[model samples]
Target: MTETSTGGKGAPATRRLSAFLYRHDRLRLAGLLTPPILWLVVLYIGSLGVMLVSSLWGVDSFTGSLVKKVSWSNYHTLFTEPVYRTVALRTLGIAISVTLIDLVLALPLAFFISKVVQGRRWRYALLIMVTMPLWASYLVKGYAWRIMFDKGGVIDWMFAPLGLHGPGLGLTATVVALAYLWLPYMVLPIYAGLERLPESLLEASADLGASPLRTLRSVVFPLLVPSVVAGSIFTFSLTLGDYIMVKIVGGTTQMFANIVYDNVGVAGNLPFAAAAAVFPIVVILGYLLAVRRSGALENL
Candidate 1:
C-alpha cells in the first residue's frame, strides 16, 4: 500500500510537468533550443574570442615566449608589410579565378541536367556524377591533380600531339585543381534554382517572339543570379582558406593561407598566425555583406 501510494504521487507530478510544458509553447521552444544555443556560444564563439584575444598579444622576440600584454603590433605588421600585401592579393586573385572558372563550367551543365535532360533517371545520374568527387578525400583529389600535372604525366601525354606541355605545378595548376574540386558546390545550387524555374515562363518568352539567346539572357540568367551568388559564396570562401591544395600543386606560390600555416608551424608564432588568419575571415564577412546588400542571401 505504501509503495503504491508513492508511485501514484510521482506519476501525478510527471503528468503535471508534461502538461505545463505542453501549455507553454515559448517555454517548450526555449527548452528545445537551449542546448544548441549553448553549444554555439561555448564552442564556436568561445574559440573565436580566444583567437581574437591571442591575436592582440605578442611574442617576445628574444625569448620566443608569449607576451601577455595586449598590443596591435601583429595587425600593424600585417598592414605595413609588403609581402603580406602581395600574398593577400595573390590569394584573392586565385580565389576569384577559381570562382569564375567554376561558374562558367557549372551554368551549362546545370541547365542541361535540370532543363534539357529528358528523364528523371538521367538527371539523377548526372547529379550523382557531379557529386561523386565530394565523397573522395580532399588529399586524394589534390594528389591526383598533382600526378596529372606532373612532368610527362597524362596532361603532357595528351598535349604532346598538339606540341604543347602541361602547366606543371604552379598557379595555373592550383587554379585548375581548385576549380575541379569546388565545381560540385557551384553546380548543385544552380541546378536547384533551374529546377524551381517554371517552364511556363520559358514558353511565354518564346510565344512573345524572343529568340533562344534572348530568353536565356533576359529570363533565365536574371532569375539565376541569386543562386549563382549563393554558390559563389561557397567556392570563393573555400578557395580563400585553402592551404593544402596550394602546397600540393602551387609549386613555389604562397597564398595567404600558406602564410598563416607557416607562421604557426614553421615560425612558431601563434600570435601572428592568429592575426594572419583574420584576413580570410574579414574578406568572407565583407563578401557576405555585399551579397546581403544585393539580396542574394534571401534566395539562399
Candidate 2:
C-alpha cells in the first residue's frame, strides 16, 4: 500500500483556533469585551479622573492662568462663592422641571401608542412621529424655540387672544425648550416598558372588577416606575450639562454649565472651570446612586 501523508499530527490553524476558543469560553468572552472595556476605562473614566485632578489645583489671580499647585482652592471657591451656589441650585431646579414636564407629557402618549393603538402600521407610524424630531439638528431645534418664544413670534400670536404672553428668553423658556427636546427620550423607554407588559395582567384586573383608573393605579403604574426613572435620568443629566440651550434661550439666567463655560472661555480660568464642572458630576452621581438603590437600573 502507499504511505499516506496524513497531514502530520498538527491541526490546521483555523481548526486549532476554533478548538482553543471552544475550550476556553472565558478567553473568548474577554476577547469580545476587551475593546469596549478599554474604551470606557481609558476614554471616559480616564478623562474624568484627569478633570478631577485638575479641579483640585489652583489658579493665578493676576495672570488668570492655571497653577499646578495641588490645593483645595478651586473647590473652596465653588463652595464659598454665593453666585456659584445660586447657579448650582437654579440649574438643579430647571433640570427637575424639565424632567417632570417630559414625564407628564410622555406618559399619556406612550400609553396610547403602545396599548390603545390597534394595528402594527399605526403603532409604528405614531412611533415615527414621536421620533421624527430627533432627526433634526439640536441647534436648529433650540433656535426654532427661541424664535417661537420671541415677542412677536408664533407663541405670542397663538396666545395673544387669551391676554397671555410667552415667557420669553428666561428660565421658563429654557425649561420649555429643554422639555421639548427631551420628550422623545422619555416617551420611547416608557413605550417599550408598556409594550412588554402582559395583556392578561390588565385583563385580570378588569375581570376582578377593578375600574380602569384602579387598574392603572394598581397594576400599571408600579410596573412603569423603573422605565420612568430611566427616562428621567437622561432628561435630568442632559439639562444639567447643557450650555448651548441656555445661551440661546436663557437671557440673563446662568446654569452651572454656563458658569463652567464662562470660566473656561471668558474668564480664561481652566482650574475654576474644572472645579465648577465637578458640581454637576457629583450631583448626577448622587442621583444615579439613589436611583440604583431603588432598583431602577436593574429593571432597565
Candidate 3:
C-alpha cells in the first residue's frame, strides 16, 4: 500500500463527519422526517377532523361562529335538498366517467408503449410526450380548452370548413378539458404496471396456444389491477375536486367542490362551506370502499 495515496486528509474529513453523525446526532436524522409527518398530522388530518366536527356544528345566527353543536341536520339537508343531491351526484358521475374514459384510453396507450415500441429512446420520448402535459398548469389547460371552444376559436374555425358549427361551448367543453387534464394521471400508473410485467409470461402464453388477446385477459390484465385501481383513484379524486375547469368551462353548472368554493369565497357562509367540503371526501371514501370490497382489492 502507498502511504502518499491518502492525499493529506480528504479521507479523515468524511470519516469524522460520519463518526459525528453516528455518535451524538440521531436527532438531526429524526428532525429531517419530522416536518412532513407533522404536516400530515396537523394540516391534512387536523383539517379533516375540523371539517367533520364543524359539519356537525349548527350555524349560529347572532354569534357568527360555529361553537359546540351536533346534529344530523346538515347531512339531512344534503339528502333532502334536491339541488345539493344533484350537484353531488354530478361531481361523482363526472369523476366516474373521466376515470372510465381514461382507463379505456390509457390501457391501450400504456400497453402499446410498454410492448410495441422497440427503441428505448422512442419509448421514453412517447412516455414523456404523454406526461409533459402534466407539467402544464390545470388552470392553463382549462383556459386553453376555453380558447379552443369559443366561437371563432380554433375548434369552431377548423370545423367551419366542413360546415359543422358545434354547440356553443360550456359544460361539454368542461368535461373534455377536465378529461384531458386528468388522463396522464391514469396513464402513468398503468404504464408503470405494464412496464414491470415479466416478458417470460408472454413467452409462456405464446408457447401454450393463447392468442394475444387471450394472453392479455388471462395473464396481463390481472397483474395490472393495482395500477388500474391507482389510476382510477387519481382521476376520480382529482376530477371530484376540480374548480378551475368547471368555473372556466361549465360557467353555470356547479360542481360540488366548485359550489363549496363559491359559497366560501362569494356567499360568505363558513358553516355551509364546511358542510360542502365534507361532501367530496365522503364520495371518495365511499368509492374507495366499494372498489376495495370488490375483487380488485386483491392487487393491494
Q: Write down the TM-score of every candidate.
A: 0.90, 0.91, 0.86
lDDT of 3 by residue, 148-221 (tens): 88888888888898999854466677677778988899999999998889889998998999999999999999
- The lDDT per prediction is 0.93, 0.89, 0.83
The residue pairs that clash in candidate 3, if any, are none
Candidate order, TM-score descending: 2, 1, 3
- Candidate 3 ranges beyond 4 A from true positions: 1-33, 157-165
Model 3 quality (TM-score) = 0.86
Better model by lDDT, 1 or 2?
Answer: 1
- Stretches off by above 4 angstroms in model 2 are 1-16, 292-300
Q: State in Å the error of residue 265, model 2.
A: 1.3
TM-score of candidate 2 relative to the true fold:
0.91
Tally clashing residue pairs in candidate 1.
Answer: 0
Distance from true location, Cα of 112 in model 2, Å: 0.7
Model 3 scores what on Cα lDDT?
0.83
Give the winner by lDDT. 1
Task: Give one clash count per candidate, in the order shown.
Answer: 0, 0, 0
Task: Please write out the lDDT profile of model 2 over residues 120-189, one tens digit for every residue.
Answer: 9999999999999999999999899989988898988998899998777889999999999999989999
lDDT of 1 by residue, 158-264 (tens): 88999999888999999999999999999999999999899999999999999999999989988998889889989999999999999998999999998889989
